[model samples]
Target: MKFFRLIICLSIICGVGSSTYAQKNFAKEADHAFFNESYFSAIEAYKKADVKAKPAEKARINYQIGECYRLMVDPAQAETFYAKAIKLKYASTNPDVLFRMADVLKQQGNYKEAQDYYEQFLSKKPGVAEAEAGLESCKKAQVWKAEPTKHIVQNEIQLNTESYDYAPAWGDKKHETLIFSSSRPGSTGDGIDDRTGESYMDLWITTRDNKGKWGEPQILPETINTEDNEGGAYMNRKGDALYFTRCPREKKTNIGCDIFYSEPQGRSWKEATKIVLKPEGADSLSCGHPTLDRKEDYMIFASDLPGGQGGKDLWITEWDKSEKKWGTPKNLGPKINTSGDEMFPHLTDEGVLYFSSNGHVGMGGLDIFRAEETGEMQWGNVENLRYPINSSEHDYGIIFEKNSDDKRGFFTSSRPEGKGRDDLYSFNLPEIKFILEVYVKNKETQEPLAGVEITLVGSDGSQVVKTTDEEGKFIYDENGSDRYIKKETSYNIEVSKDEFLGAKSKFSTVGEENSKKYIEELFMQPASKDVVIDFPEVQYAYDKHELLVDDRINSEDSLDYLYQTLVDNPTIVIELQAHTDCRGSDKYNKALSQRRAQSCVDYLISKGIPADRMVPAGYGETTPRAPGLECETIENMATNEEKEVAHQKNRRTQFRVLSFDYKPSGSGGE
Candidate 1:
């Protein structure tokens, strides 16, 4: 009986082995067809293997079929196969299969379900950073609002899509004509893009008629557009000048873009000239998407210089109308930049900056963000535009429509329903709301003084309590809570620090005013000090050394303080030193420093300081308070910068009291 049972088992095993061999042959053919790009044939071969294959083998066959369908762009069919394979539980224990399922769910925009699979995959593979990033993105997507279905447009005004229209920019002045870049068939340069096989992009203009309709769009003449790619345009308020980016491709090398500007002539634009704000050796560095302030004196653009934090960063340069050139560009720094690409900067009349970035947590690829200019060359922290506007796709090139009532704007995206590549979409931004922050510091040392308390007592006797951070910074929300109606309330801010005089300041904003943004910074003083002296404000001549006659040698404010200092210390000997910024000849600067020092001494004598007790000296451009400092003198700098800041640092007067000994009237003194 045992021998008979063994013979029967052997016969059954042989039958099972024969079936597996046949199934393996079918899977091999399917994989070969898939590798050859014959996806349809691979699917048919896979179906044949599925019938004879066991549970695990069948699941593997289905996964391969799903991959082929995904590569063929049939995501729905691929999703179906992945779901079937998952149900079979062959790869339910493997993280790779779970990740594939999550990716398909994400492509379908079912973020909630995708998130579940992503979490499971991450649970199995504990240290996958990309999986974590995707999980966060899905979480954001789950809560994000859907894009608005209705367009916000004025009555009878329609967006013109007659030709290939995109990349719109507004002049500095309000209600001026709209300038855009297009690749219409009638453009002058009949050549096509080597990569896309489409017409090259060039700048175009469309004027606004009295009826508020855009007139026919026309390509800028040959002198301005050129045969190369010319886009990313900006115009001055007067419309007399224009700045744009031009990328002229050289045969095989990947030449980067540069900024150029053209002045308007009687009817047409003159020949465009290259603006060299970057150093000569760094021509390979890219600088584009420039936006000038209303005055056209300041410009902000983007560059990918080596020293930047990472990727492309924003930079600014000032226009020197006298030199007919641009000053050196300075990076906007870490506050506005991250380790991701930031581009498309747009400056508003209200000093609000609109730019796009991929660094910040966003709905997707690139999100439009806003920042306010806090100081002369500094910007506040950036805030994302947030839901409905940004999506998990490449969204960029945002610009506001001029003279529109609804605050409607246009931006580009490569989202699902677009006409191949990127398409322009219109959106209306919500009302402007912000949080105002104030920072206080010691003027002398520029160090943050903490433990300072401030009370915000409104005019209505309603108190909103707050305190400063360890860094002497305080934040106030402009839009208060729902129950607290925001109104124009005068705030009596009482500030106090240890061992220092207490001070009070007041501020109130007009109610329902949405046009302007406001910020105030205050510097406080210590209660007492041993000696106090005021320095005279210095002035300089333009490219010359002769001081103006009417100019007072000593300011009354300085003289008053000097007299008080002498009265407080009757027998004090003082020394005054003068310095000059790094400009002009070294010997000439030394002589000028000496003359300036003597001038101070003469002024002190006129104020009744004993001449015998005073010493005057000059240091010229040496002994700088801030060493190796960039941005000082306009001339003799390493870079081609017109050193405005260097000059300011150089023109200063410093004083030191040498001795303070007085003789007693009735007693002998040695």
Candidate 2:
């Protein structure tokens, strides 16, 4: 009774009625229409044959009716016929019937009943992956409904008709023009498609008004819109090339759809030519829903060709630029695809791939999911976009705005309360703005320093370079000329000027609530010789000369700063100055200080700094950090706590720049 089994069980069951001639005639007509993809005509014929059908013929007739409704995407009607077929025990060996029934129930939002049918199907056929996914989706559907996303979806009424109008694509970089496929009135051909019982689809173009309202929908020129069913339009990032689907009607069933492309001719498009992504003479196979990567070097599409995972697996092919030809098609593999259909792939500029899949565990029907490309031609961590972005209807063909950071886009959906069989809906995440304003200043004079180059590097691999304006400030926000910084991403800000020392700092928008403006001041010191900085205490155990464990550059640890400073100022040479308290013997303290200073130098050398760039000196118990402390004797200190504090200050390490020029052994210049 299931769709796949119906192909194998094509032979009709004979009727044991007195009027066998009429019963057989009606059943024969229905089978002919069904085989030719004329589900509308087949549904009518099957109903007429139902009355005269025998007990055995009844189940097959009901199952055929269910198939017609399912293909039409009418789950409510399909559920009724499938239930009847199940009650009659039609094709009891085919567990696909139970699974199909469960699928329809899920689409209708009856999760409990759908779960029951999924369990029944799984009981007979254990380890069925699709059935297991269906059960999991039912549970997730309930949870998703309870906590839906903040996306407020609106049906674009002006551009829609009382027919299938979907698969919207932005025709311009600014998204001022829109192009989509529609099977509404005034198509190229007056003929109706047997698949959907509607007029053949055609590409339509529309424009958005200055007030953000859609204008009248107009059919594209005859160059692109032909007598055949042409739709599923996708354009390259530059908007110079457009790829679409063309399903030419055949004598029997339609010659399977193939992907075709057209070049822009001024403001309009020229006649389309087939891309020939697959091997020659594979006319029976269907390919559609083309998506080109940001670089336009590779394209992914949905195809029902042979040697796929199953029905309509997503396949990719590289575009040979110099040769100007498409390479062989390759499947996306099992992680992103399944036995069920996967289509409508959209690869974002950020390398995040979004596609629609029925095989993946989702609410029901085709749900939109996104996956980050982990490596070359590899994708994982698939996540369903969740409702109300995806619904229990066929939601697909999403298109995002060019250079958009706020996640604004339009998608096609057939959910109820729409103006047509399928309508376009606009969605955008609520923009939470965070502004960063950084001011560069002189460390010694506290005067603002203008024209300082500030470079921001993000954890997401985003880098922006800017110079401080006359106000000695660089500002970044959602409305800035530069790329917007996203939330939950840490960024490192590096500031430098001609005569000033380079400075580095970091900030993050993680866990920030409400829109806030952050003001930060970065002070740069003069890059001169013998520049000393008071450093952190190198906490060594009692009488110990070795460095502590966990030697990393962090808030608590400052030893790595010695290495980083050398890296930042690559040509600069420095000396490690180590000191100790007055508690120990002078000679012993000197030995300990020397070892500590050598430890600092060794750490720097291990980090790839040349040994000649650093010099170690021990000023043990000789130069006290607290100049006011009378260190002639330990008893001369004010109190025990005061003496301990002074000693703690004295038992520290500092570095002073020796020279700004230090050449490597083979690099020549000094």
Candidate 3:
């Protein structure tokens, strides 16, 4: 439900009056008030008439009361009356009650039940676009509220009241002064509005202090606030020109609301002028919720004028420099307008248009949607801002905290969590957090290795060096202060210990939109050349030198560890050695082992590693992984399985560091 920014003059088809109470004084008065848009007065009259009326009369009266509340932006009470009328079988006479009930239910965020009611209405009257759109909205809104955006929404308690208060806009370029509409107790308008039962809305202002605290609210001067509906104001980027809505006190007529313009004079604004928008003789058409583009070359406003998509459509009018007035209004087309009401259009300085609509597929009621101007006036990618920025109620009239920072702002919402029927809520998008926890451990011992030097290098040309603590844990994050890992960036994590070979892995935030915590467990091997690191899984095809590549496994991939090791420790040269079982002659086995080692060296060379960085070596089966488990000893064993195990351990692919200095050809240093 919405209040100030809501389109109140949209065509509403009232339920048929009961023949039993058609001539009665209470029922007659209620009908007259309802037809004249005095919904608050009509509801009171309808309730009194319902007290003594028959069941059929009572059903219609209750339904009418529900309609009043719905228009007045009170979904809870509207739902109550609509459910009562439906229980009395009013829906059987008028199936539109189902649609009305669904609307109110959705506004309350009971999306599943609302969809059911919408489907029921659709079955009764197939192909109703409004009902179809509502049904789709129910389903879509459920997902939006379930996985809302990063925006954190909180009711601006200092600026809200139990009465209607909404549609906040920045009153100053600095964004320190906030101007919003409130129908609280101290509004300048006197007496109750027969339409809303609250004092006619007035613009109010509150200033945020230098300490970033918002001060108490104060109403605008009398020049702007009249004994009429006045709210939903927007200021140009210059902050000098003010555009606001004004619904004059015509309780029983559809004379229509209009937009007004005012200029600031010292602490107060000058007398406002009614901005003539509609065509001549279209005085019955209502137009309000005025907003201007950043350049002030164009104005977008909500209106029920002709040539729109439907209900109330957002229209744009270009400023005519020659005529010193705005040109004829042009509809924003189906891309922006829909068959349902679209109101409260606000265009940011960045050409992003934000508005609220019941038309587009939404979470519920009036959901906030944004569109970017693609061409001269064409727009695309009309996306919902999503919940909690958009709840299952009337949410509209959004304004950012400043032109530069879009993620923080104030907007209107009639969702139940607010302090009023429609309250102003401050919203902000929290920064996405990226953290990397590096746990260094010894490869041979599998124990935590402390005091290891950790170097994090980012592709964004940022690097940070941190040492592992006594726990062998280095928490590498922004730490809520200094950020090294950032969006659209890749980082290399290098861990080096005094006696261990450096280990490196890649961690990136690129293509990742959500906050993430990386738990990287790095194992560093002892750097001594005697510590032979074996690749047992990497085997050859039964005496052939080529690396194995088959469906079961690709042994070539296992060598990537050595490939990365050579790349990480660029200055180190490695001896890629291969061994064999003593099944063949010593000379033949040595030649075969040499080819196998060269095959691995060739594979690394194809992956961009320099060939000179590796030296291939083949050792005939002279060494055994198990100290004395030689082939002759394996032959003495009783079981044939024991001999094969000894032979398999002898056949292996292993490597060792040759030197720690490997200068490139162009380097002069040796």
Best by lDDT: 3
Give the top-scoring candidate (TM-score).
3
- lDDT tens per residue, model 2, 510-606: 8875566777789887656545665555666678767765545232256776677778777777778888988878999999999988887887777
Candidate 1 on 1-670: residue-level lDDT in tens?
Answer: 0011001110000001123345558787777656543455567778888889999888888888887666443456778998888888856655577777776666556788878988988888977755676677677665664533234322112333433344567644665477776656666666554222356667887776787666777778788887676777888778888988876655424356778889988888899988886677865566777888888888998777667767778888988889877898888888898777677788877778888876665655566788888998789778767555666554566777665542787765545555533445667654444345556666566677677676667787777655668888777664344322135655666665643434456766547444333354655444232333235554435443333344555344554565555554565666667778766677887888788777767766887777866677777777564655432434556554436656676577666656555343555776
Task: Go through the candidates in order and give each one's C-alpha lDDT.
Answer: 0.64, 0.79, 0.83
Output the better candidate (1/2) by lDDT. Answer: 2
By TM-score, the candidates rank as 3, 2, 1
Between prediction 2 and prediction 3, the one with superior TM-score is 3
User: If both were scored by lDDT, which would come out higher, candidate 1 or candidate 3?
Assistant: 3
lDDT tens digits by residue: candidate 3, 276-329: 889999777878888888789999989999999988999998999999888889
Locate the minimum summed-lDDT window of 10 residues in model 2: 2-11
Give the TM-scores of the predictions, in the order they appear. 0.47, 0.63, 0.83
Off by over 4 Å in 1: 1-134, 146-164, 320-324, 401-406, 417-421, 429-670
Q: Which residue pairs clash within candidate 1?
A: 632-646, 633-643, 633-646, 634-642, 634-643
